[model samples]
Target: MYKHLVVAVDGSATSLNALQHACSLAEMSNAKITLVHVANPSEYMAMAPEFMHHASYEEAAVAQGNEVLDFAEKAVQEAGLSDVVKHLLVANKGARDMAQELVDYADEQGAELLVLGTHGRSGLMHLLMGSFAETVMRQSHLPLLVIRSQKDEDE
Candidate 1:
């Protein structure tokens, strides 16, 4: 039984599904849920035009991350679980990737279970975009519960 669970949320439907699953498990075990959203400025920068301001982009990324965490926390509370913690992690340049950050945070939180949603991309797409869930699984020392994207199944 898990006493503490760390879940990654990115304001995506898949992430919401993962949070829902985490809530169910938390209810069963009376575990505390720690919701984490990584704000990777580098990702935003990569997508932004060269003329865009870095400071504004970073701020936007952090703001979005906070919004995602707030939404996830509300969902957890609405699920009737009060023991919830939210973290907005900023991914620095030349540092660990988002997956590593999540894994490290889970370990720091002393979580028994790490939960996340995966887009389930395969073949060319998977190779090009890579799988965040897969990276986390490889780096994490604790148990992981991966919830595949419902959209993928629907398609």
Candidate 2:
């Protein structure tokens, strides 16, 4: 029933799974796919010492983000999805607001579904890093399908 689908990727296996799932759903429903990769340079810039090169750090992050998107798009195309779109966004740094940006972009694009994967972090790791999927679920109105990471499922 969904016509527009948004899938977020970050060059992680979990995200790769999400992309594959999105591709299958899109193919089945004849929906369009939008692959989004967000580059938040602020975290890197802030953490680097003043002596380190800032421009190179930001450039590397953007390049990596684009690579992630490229890989995701390739996988989708191989899955027989034709109407696929890609977006590489530079989000505000340090706020851990990628969730809000993804939600906003999906809404702006009139996406019917937002698909992503959770690393299933817990304990200290969860407390320190937080969870993007949880944030998006709490803030977005669009339907979400969050796939657990294979590692998590195995455990």
Q: Which of the numbered candidates is closest to the native, going by highest TM-score?
A: 1
**Cα TM-score per model:** 0.90, 0.88
Candidate 2 stretches greater than 4 Å from native: 46-56, 152-155
lDDT (C-alpha) at residue 43 in model 2? 57
Clashes of each: 0, 0
lDDT of 2 by residue, 1-155 (tens): 99999998988888998888898899889999999988887656656476554366677668878889999989998998889999987776542578889999999999999999889889998899888888889989999999889965536
Error of 1 at 109 (Å): 1.1
Candidate 1 on 44-151: residue-level lDDT in tens?
766647656445778878988998999999999999999999998877752247788888888888999999998899999888888889889889889999999986
